[model samples]
Target: MNTSASHDPNCIFCKIIAGQIPSKKVCEDEQVYAFHDINPWAPVHFMLVPKAHISSMAQLGQEHAALMGHIMTLAPRLALEQGCNPYPDGGFRVVVNTGAEGGQEVQHLHVHVMGGPRPWAKG
Candidate 1:
């Protein structure tokens, strides 16, 4: 719930957002930063992260509702823009790894958007 900080100098995502680290950016705005995963799980694999330094989903509170909704609504558009086929038959998957047990590699909260063809190595 300590969402006051806009960036974390030690957080990798923050560095990517601040341009201190290079990333294959998909899209970015005042609220979120979307970038391609270096080790893609699917043909179209990217992540959408908040500009603010939120450690993980466990830290999210009701105050983050609007931001979370914005991320959800924006996912499809970004997925399509990244070459994921349209919905119904071809769509994307949104994943949020909560903590260490949940498989989050980085401390920064990010929604993994993966889609495109089958035979993907893993999700």
Candidate 2:
């Protein structure tokens, strides 16, 4: 996911990182990008994605483990920033949609940060 979606030339995420596409950015770094999802699944449904453009989990090998850990760590931190665990509450959900059958919309790998439980939380 962090390999440069630009390779596709039509990658929406790459276009976004390149400023060719528009997105409501939540965070950004040299190696990653975070933004609000177009069709959010939850109140805090944001995306933390690597800039490398790695397509799916199956495509990731040894080199990706570090980045994966970083993504996971970043998720909870960002969730807290977004007001997760507010009041006496606690925790949020981070989802990685792996493949087409897994409900991944974009080809780029992205971590879905979800908070403020909704109806979908039940099933």
Off by over 4 Å in 2: 1-6, 86-88, 120-123
**What TM-score do all the candidates reach, one by one?**
0.95, 0.85
- The local lDDT score (0 to 100) that residue 28 gets in candidate 1 is 90
Candidate 1 per-residue C-alpha lDDT over 1-123 given as tens digits, one digit per residue, 9 for 90 to 100: 555478889999999999999999999999999999999899999999999999999889898899999999999999999999998989888999988899999999999999998878574
Give the Å shift of residue 22 in candidate 1. 0.6
RMSD of 2: 2.9
Error of 2 at 122 (Å): 7.2
After the best TM-score superposition of candidate 2, give how far the Cα of residue 90 lies from its true spot, in angstroms. 2.3
Q: Against the true structure, candidate 1 has what lDDT? A: 0.92
Best by lDDT: 1
TM accuracy, model 2: 0.85
